[model samples]
Target: MPIDIETFDESSSDELNTLTNAEMVVRFLATNDDKAYTPSEIAERIDIKKNSIGTVLSRLEDRNLVRHKGDYWAIGERETVRDAYRTHRIMEALDERYGEEDLEEWREHAAEGE
Candidate 1:
């Protein structure tokens, strides 16, 4: 979500003035952590028009920084998401060749050496 223009305490809109519409949207969403937002909710909080919110969200989604879950939008590129994808890819490629028990033993031995 964009900064709550009414509640944000900045004396001037200087900081927001320099940002492109997409950047402003990103900054707002970043500050909200994992919170999901809708186009209308985003418009209410920032300088963006309600109509433009969907466009900005589409751009962010294309860049892989935002994603939609049903009707709600949330941050993408989170560590958990990235790690899960990476881990799945790795396991799919290697699981046929390595037994889970062997991998566990190897991990324990590696940890003991440290």
Candidate 2:
């Protein structure tokens, strides 16, 4: 079957819009790491304020969702590697309809069953 891009944008929810900038940042990190992203690569992906990514990374570290592997980030011991893989799947699914910005916005909506 052909991929239909509209599926990701329609049937959304309020919770998605509720995702704070920090949460959005975590989701991005979670997503890229699943795709085997490097810190430099993730740095290239986000256009947030200076040190914001660092703060988010620090927070993820505190939450045990990610760890610093030398200069790169790795999945946490307590975190589910499959979760990263799942986000990658969702990224592939929605990429046709949404750009990076839209995907970030769509997260909570999709999380809420978009």
Candidate 3:
């Protein structure tokens, strides 16, 4: 189920505020594969400056959240796995707020050959 608009009203801004530079990096990694991504790629993908991505990457690397592999930036040994299912729940909630009408359940409810 997609997130409903009513749910958006109940959401806390603090949750959004909790996203930091490293978290941004983590989210990007989570969005992509388990391979090593260069700082340039991150900057391009996230629309952040290359220098800023570099700094964030350095911090994440130091904290063991990411590690360098054979020309790839892979998740570090200490990196904690994120729950993709939970993210789906969050995405559903947001979609509801945005008034998205293409939700699967809603499509199933549509009339035939109207």
Candidate 4:
């Protein structure tokens, strides 16, 4: 038996290369928001490692960015997701125009709370 090989055009390859695992998972779930899937299903469809999916899903759940019930996962509220995307785009634009923020500098200036 022989295995099948997959191929991508230039644009698709570039797009895939630029997206992080979290982004890919979010995009996949968003596109199929009408349906829920197990982590294995999402990993297979997104071509990500099964082990990594759990961590990603857990983090997203903690942030209320995604929902999980039983063994299935689905995207969170549409408005929340949209707001997150909008904020991410704004950050990207700011980074491009003024350079990425220095984490240490930000931490130094951050207000302390009781």
In the range 34-92, model 4's lDDT, one tens digit per residue, is 99999999999988899899999999888778999999999999999989988987897
* lDDT for each residue of candidate 1 in 4-113, tens digit (9 for 90 to 100): 65426752455445666775666566667569888788777765788888998998788777788877887676764456446744774586477445778898999999
Clash totals for all models, in order? 0, 2, 7, 0
Best by lDDT: 4
lDDT of each: 0.69, 0.56, 0.61, 0.82
lDDT per residue for candidate 2 within 7-99, as digits (tens), equals 235324442444544555555555455644455555456545545667777776786677786667765653454575467558856874675
TM-score of 4: 0.80
Query: Which of the two, 2 or 3, has more TM-score?
Result: 3
TM-score of each: 0.53, 0.44, 0.49, 0.80
Arrange candidates, best lDDT first: 4, 1, 3, 2
lDDT (Cα, tens digit) per residue for candidate 3, span 52-100: 8767777777866676755456555532434533564578688768865
* Per-residue error (Å), model 3, residue 99: 35
User: What's the residue-level lDDT of 28 in candidate 3?
Assistant: 63
Of candidates 2 and 1, the better by TM-score: 1
RMSD of 1: 14.9
Question: If both were scored by lDDT, which would come out higher, candidate 1 or candidate 4?
Answer: 4
